[model samples]
Each structure stands twice: as C-alpha cells, then as structure tokens.
Target: MRRGRVLGALLPLLLLATGCGIRSTDVVEVGDPATVEVAPGAQQGTVLYFISSSSPGGLLPVVRQVDDPSATSSSGTGDDGRSRGKQLALLFMGPSRAERKGGLRSELPMSSDQVSVTTGQEGIRVRLASGVNQLSELARQQLICTVAYERGQGTTVTVLGTDGSIGPARCSV
Candidate 1:
C-alpha cells in the first residue's frame, strides 16, 4: 500500500515535469483547416491564410483557384506544377487586392524569396533569414498553420532561422 501511494504521487509530478517547454500556446482559430488533395477528387485551388480585419490577430483562409485543374498533391506539392517553394512564393505575394479590401493581410516579416524549402520524412523545413527569436509568435503561428493546412492537419513543419530553429510543430486547429 505504501509503495503504491509513493508511485501514485510521483506519477503526477512526472507528468507535470515533462513538456515541450512552452507552457501554453494560444490556438489561433481560423475556420476548418483546408486540406489540399491533388488526386482524383482533389480541390482545384490553393488555400492561403491571412490575418483578417475583423479578427485582429486571427488567421483567415483565402482559397485561390490554381491554373492547374488537378490542383495540389497529397504529398504537399502541386500536380499543377507549383512546388512547395512556389507555393510559399505565392504566400509572400500577400492577399489579392480584392482580398485586401475584404481585410486579409499577411503577417510574414519577409518574402518567400528570403527562404529556402526542403522536404523529407521529417516534413517540410523552411530556412529563413530571421532568427527564431526574431519572429513574433504570431508570425510563427501563421507559418505553422499555413503549412499544416497545406500539407495536412498532422503534418510537422519546421522553420530554421539564421540564429536558430522553431518547430517540428503542428497546428492543433
């Protein structure tokens, strides 16, 4: 009985001691995450997230039809011929003029031209000129959520900055 009590007490402490270091993260709500599927019933457009005027700091997704009818691939690339880098470039382009009038805007500190992309089993890795600490958490959230929606809900995305790296993180929303 005594040993069981000790073990039980330690268990809660052990659970509390283990964490990813971030004590808490705000779940930036956007609507349902957009999943780009480029197979036989794939969506014929790309979804880009931007900050909305009404929702101050929240992300708003904007779907733009790609020239390619097949749209994107399940592997996070586009069968439409837009690779991950090209997709990221489109993100850097910001929302369209009509979108801006509707209140969608980007939070990225730099353009896609400032970053390089690579993909493997670990997921997509984006290298940036800014340091990990240099980016605001909101900016990081924007990147993570966009990648998560693009690649799939559970897909892991990592950003490597000149000073450091952030994530192998997934957006819960």
Candidate 2:
C-alpha cells in the first residue's frame, strides 16, 4: 500500500515534468511586428559607413545630424525616404576628425564630384564621372556599403561607369 501510494504520487509529477508547460493549442498569430516611423519634419541623422578594423565588414557606421531630406526636397515625396546624392556627398566627406583619430578610414577612391549618386523608383544609381572599373574591390565595397546603409534594405547599387559600362554591386557581408 505504501509503494502504491508513492508510485501514484510520483506518477503525476513525472507526467508533468515530461510535458511542456504550453499544452494548449496551435500556433498563435500575434499580428505584425511594430515599426518605428520617423516623422518627415524631424531632423534625422544620416548614417555613413567608413572603414574600421574592429567592425564586422571593416565598414563602420557614423551618424551625423542632417536636415531631414524628406522635409527639404521634392524628391522626398517618393517612398525612397532618403536623399541618396546628399548622403553620398556626406560619405565623400569621410570620417570626422575624431573618427579618424579613432582609426576609421575610407577607401572610396573617388572625390564627391567624381560620382553622381541618385535614387528614384528604379533604385539607387551611381554614375562615375571617371573610372569605376579601376576602383579596387575594397573601394567598391566601401561605396556599396555606404549606399546600402543610406538606402536601407541592403539593396544593390547600379553603377554607370565612364566606360559606358553599368554594373550592380550588393553588399556581400
């Protein structure tokens, strides 16, 4: 009778231990995830990617306060949500004095004037006034990474090089 009582007492506990706490039902739909929407009129910080030894891809992001493009330009009317050319201009400015001292660098291999970056319904495009093919792979990665960060979504950038050749670059990392 004692062994029967002990076995009966332990059986329920063992059953509970073997079962998951969530024994109720099928997969639950929690609806969509929340998203952060930036107000168009607000001053937004632009993200620029510079080369850094400590970063995962050697591309480090530095945020600088910029006048909100959506608030300032007609191009902002579209869903693209950013001023690509303007951000590229900022990227061309490279890392700030403090950033450089901290070991951030750039391998863009072109001046701001040498490249024209634009975005539209078709997507972000970069036209090189000079050499695009001549750019080293690292330099290309720097450009690709900056544009991807600026554009969001890690999308590809189509380059219109001076050689009348156009190609697309996507971030491998």
Candidate 3:
C-alpha cells in the first residue's frame, strides 16, 4: 500500500516533467505573413576577399560601404553584376588603403583588366588573362571566395585561363 502511494505521487511528477521537455527554441517559424515588401539589391555595403595578414594562406572577408563606381569607374555592379562590376573590380584592385592599413593583402593579379566575369546558365565564369594553373592556392581561394560571395555561397564558378584551360571550383566560404 505504501509503495502504491509512492508510485502514485511520483507518476504525476514524472508526467509533469515529461510535458515540459519541449523547449521554446525547438520550434522554427519561416516566412512573414506581413504584406510589407522591400526592393531586392545589394546591401549598402560590399564584401571583399583578401589575404589574412597573420595567415598569408587564408582568405579574409571584409565588408565595407559601397563607393561610387564612377570614382573608380569599373564594370560590374557590387555582387549582382547586372549594371556595373564593382565588387569584382574592387577585389582585383586589391585591399583598399584602409584595408592595407588594417593588415589585409590580396594575391590577385595587379592588373584588374586581366580578369573578366560572365554569367551563364552554368553559373558565372571568371576568365583569367593568365593561366589558371599559374595561380597559387591562396590566389585561387581569394578569387573563389570573392566571386562566390557576389554570386551566392556555394555557387559554381568556372575559371578559364588564357591557354584555354578550364578549372572547376566551388565556393567553400
């Protein structure tokens, strides 16, 4: 009888504890029901891939406010790359003055004109004026991350060299 009373008391407690197992964080809600709409475009700032000062082999992604394209007068837009090519051009230009002061560097070629970008159904193709195999691993990574950041994470990018060599790579960032 005593055992029965003990179990009866513990049963309710056990049931109560199990009922509270669900956490507020366990549920995920997606999409907003509101009618408010916003324009789709590049964020006010841009992301550029550079070489880390401490680790020369690694890539350092930096976000900076968008500058006037005409100030430098590049080709592609930020990342969208529809109107003008800013992100890729700025990346090829290497780290900005402020960025260099902050200890970031770039392995990309000195001449930004040597690089060209074309978007196709297969994805964006980065045509390098030099041989793709000539690029160091760090340089290749720097190019991949920068273009991928603009195109979208994990997007397919083909690097074409002037020698008619084509290399396939994906953005791991």
lDDT of each: 0.67, 0.66, 0.67
lDDT of 2 by residue, 1-173 (tens): 99999999999998898785656688999999998743232245666667889977767666666666452222334433245566667777777788899999887654756556666666668876766677666667777766665345567777777765444667655
Worst 10 residues of 1 by lDDT: 72-81
- Residue-level lDDT of model 1, residues 7-26, one tens digit each, is 99999888878863658778
Candidate 1 achieves a global lDDT of: 0.67
The TM-score between candidate 3 and the true structure equals 0.63
Candidate 2: RMSD to truth = 4.7
Model 3 global lDDT (CA atoms, 0 to 1): 0.67
Which parts of model 1 have CA positions greater than 4 angstroms off? Answer: 1-42, 53-57, 69-82, 110-114, 129-132
Rank by lDDT, highest first.
1, 3, 2
- Alpha-carbon runs more than 4 Å astray in model 2: 1-14, 17-23, 34-43, 67-76, 79-83, 110-114, 120-122, 163-166
- What are the candidates' C-alpha RMSDs? 15.3, 4.7, 6.4
Candidate 3 residue-wise lDDT, 65-161, digit = tens: 5665333223344433432245667777888898899889887777756556777777778876677777777888777776766555667778887
